[model samples]
Target: MSDAILTLDNVTKVFGRADKPVYAARAVSFALHPGRTLALVGESGSGKTTAARLIMREYTPDEGQLLFRGVPLGKGDARALRNYRSSVQMVFQDPFASLNPTHTIRYHLERPLKLHQKGLTSAQRQAAIVELLERVKLDPKLIMPKFPHELSGGQRQRISIARALAVNPQVIVADEPTSMLDVSVRQGILNLLNDMKAELKLALLYITHDIATARYVADDIMVMYAGQIVEWGAVNKVLDDPQHPYTRLLLSAVPDPDRRFDDVRFADELGRVEEIRTLSARPQPETAQAGENHFYRPFPAV
Candidate 1:
């Protein structure tokens, strides 16, 4: 009953046929409050993207419903869905792939304004585009005329962000926005995102495998393993005092170092992480709150 902008109530996503199906997301539940960020952290194939997809309305959940400001979204109304799309935007993982190579950056930003802000004239649309570019700290005159490939990776990412903001979105789902950029430029992008969130008060869903980056922007963190959220709470509390085995296994992997991305070092702990993942994925039998904010889904037999 919180004043959350977006909430997923026991969301689940299954793939393949009934006989042999994979539950990409299992009863995943979380809320994105206005002016705050939620960091969905896990290794690859841990259902981080699946959660993002569910929020973005790209994939419908088979079990639960998605609520926007406490009202469930239905397919019957075009106007509501259109408004939802305009308010909810996304910045993809690969900036280059997200943009069109043939089109200039200005074209990309202007199209959204034309579609969403019909009240604005051509002159006003152009001005808005320039302002959007400047908001991401990109020089409008120089960067707007250039194509996607002409700019650097970081610049392309800035353009991607600029486009997402063109329609004046209230929520942004950035799926690993910095994972593709060079290490040197990653900090700049992270800072830019932090600034935008503060200025616009947008609810952001930052999906990534890098826990260190998540610590920088997220107010809350949800640790996912084997397509389920095993631990979730305030960012520092859960990350600093992680109780679940899979959460600890994810933290032990040196995120900034040259360590293997998938190499959960605790892999040798008598299958502790995987065993916990399978056990945790099942529905929690009852509520067991650890503290004011900390919560963990207990294993079936543990």
Candidate 2:
């Protein structure tokens, strides 16, 4: 995207010895644009969290770089780093663990305003907190004074979203924001994200293993496997007619109410799971386009 607020340019993060390297992220590249969401979909060990950590600056890239608004990160001075921190906010996976049990929702939202949004008077900060709470669909009057422990899973997650918004961040990296909540409330959170993206024009990086939710909330999608982005494009194009074998493998696993146990396509993909994993792990720099917007790495030779 030409107007991407944040871009990962050929970023790589590795662990273990140089001779026997473990690739957590290998040449991963994508962009997050304002008012749109880029979903990173993968299995648990497929380097999804590693990518989030890279953006959060909890772990530095072993190769390549992160570009925030066209400027390379880590090279800038402390003030630039602080600006990056406030601009890129993270909503973690677990709402229960992300917030303090003792802290009221008001406190959680107030702290960020005090830090990043300095110069707000006490009354102004309180108003800002109320606005944030309302933005996330929480009733400020009822929610502000309640401790994290008093809220339901979904409400606490809403508070998490409110807290992230407190900094007036341009980008939000939500790592499985709805996974812990009941399936009934998941859509509410997703709707809130979509509303925030449209109304506030915030760029969103939604990281999840759930294909159904990805299809619902994302504008674009990247299918990651074995530390590499094997396929990516407009969400409907990529998910409707997946090109990569690994991408097909993931779609095969999603429970289909209409698909029978003896469905041939399901059996075929599931049968090659091991083979697909083995081949997908090998580095494939070559790319192939399936459609105008859909693209994938060509499957390696067996």
Candidate 3:
């Protein structure tokens, strides 16, 4: 990732006592460049969310550095840290939980401008809120005064994106933005993310367990397992030509229009998942360049 807007340098995070430990992240590393998205995919308890937490500054890395615009974060100058907070906003996993039930959407968007762009007056801030709503394809006049429960799931998500843009962020961390929405609406949310990335030149971290959705929004993909990135590369290259057993296992779960999640198939693969996990959890000797753009760790001999 050349000219990255955000970079995690050998970042590590742990949860538990010093005597015993649950290693949530182990030397995890990656970068997010402007106008591109990096999708982090893995099953439950696979450290996908932990990585997001680290980038969001909800959890500081116990072991490594987080760099924003080539400057190392944590203990930076007051002005620099302020910029980081304002410029790196997150769209959480649940739109319903993230928004304020008591406040109107206009209040949510206006407060950020008040706190971050103090130069803007009340009239200018109000105008900017409407523009943001318009940018996300919402009717500002109709939706601005509505509370969270009043809008549809997709509309709430668009409001979340609009609020994220309120601070004029250069990087967006969207964790499973569409996972909870109806399938019919998922594509619309994905397309909105794609358009935001291209038009605003915003770097994005699109985190999810679903590789199929990852393909729709990201340019690059990283497959995580047991706190390590087992495979990564260009999204299509890695998905179409997966080199890791774990990656293949995940890809196998996607629903095809003709084939549902259960259609009398994958019985054998489902039965052998424990074996795949066993092999995948073993320490890899090194990364192997398995394709022109794909890379993964080979399973150790049984």
Candidate 4:
């Protein structure tokens, strides 16, 4: 997208020995545009978290560059770095762990304001905190004084969201935001994220292994395997017609109401599909367009 707030241009990060390096992220590329959510879906150890880390600046790319508002991120000065930090925030997978048990919810929210929004008076900061809680659909009066231990998983996650918003960030990297919550409250968190993306025009990167939830929350979808984005495009087009074997394997794992538990065909298909998994560990740079907005790297002939 031309107006993307953040862009990962052919980014790559590796670890292990030079003779046998592990490509955590191999020539990975994607952009986060405002008012949109790009869901990064994959199994554990699939480099989804690696991509998030790259964006968070927790791990700098061994190759390629990250551009924030069209300027190279690594080349930024101290003030620019501070602006980048405030502009891109993260809502982590574990809400309780991301928060401090000793601190009140108010403390969690107030620190960001005190740091990034330095001009705000005590009263204004309090008002901003209240507004943030309300934005995440929490009751500021009730939640402000509670510690992290007192709140449920869902509530803590909301507080996390509120904290990210405190800095007025443009990009939000939500790594498995709802995975730890109960199934009943999972939809509520997804809904809140959707609402926030629309209302605040935030660019959101939602990382998860749940294909079903990705379909629910993302405008665009990218399927990662051994660090490669095998397929990506508009959520509906890619999910409905998954062109890559890895992408199809992911969608196949989601619960299917029409398929019977004892069906021999279903089991056989899964076994056959799994063969593609090992092949994906190698780099596949070739690509083919499946639809106007859909694309995938072709699997080597089985």
Top of the candidates by TM-score: 2
Arrange candidates by TM-score, descending.
2, 4, 3, 1
- Model 3 lDDT tens row, 156-213: 9999999999999999999989988998988889999999999999999999977788
Q: Estimate each model's TM-score.
A: 0.92, 0.98, 0.94, 0.96
Show model 2 residue runs off by greater than 4 Å: none
Q: Write the per-residue lDDT of candidate 4 for residues 1-302, one digit (tens) a residue.
A: 54989999999999999999999999999999999999999999999999999998889899999998898886557787688889999999998799999999999999999999999999999999999999989999999999999999999999999999999999999999999999999999999999999998999999999888999999999999998999999999999998987887777777879877787765665887647888877789888999888999998765
Q: Return the TM-score for candidate 3, rounded to 2 decimals.
A: 0.94
Backbone clashes in candidate 1 total 0
Candidate order by decreasing lDDT: 2, 4, 3, 1
- Candidate 3: worst 10 consecutive residues by lDDT? 259-268
Model 1 — TM-score against the truth?
0.92
Q: What lDDT does candidate 4 reach at residue 28? A: 95
Which tens-of-lDDT digit does each residue in 151-259 have in candidate 2? 9999999999998988989999999999999999999999999999999899999999999999999999999998999999999999999999999999999987898
Judge candidate 4 at residue 251 and give its lDDT: 75
| 1 against 3, candidate with superior lDDT | 3
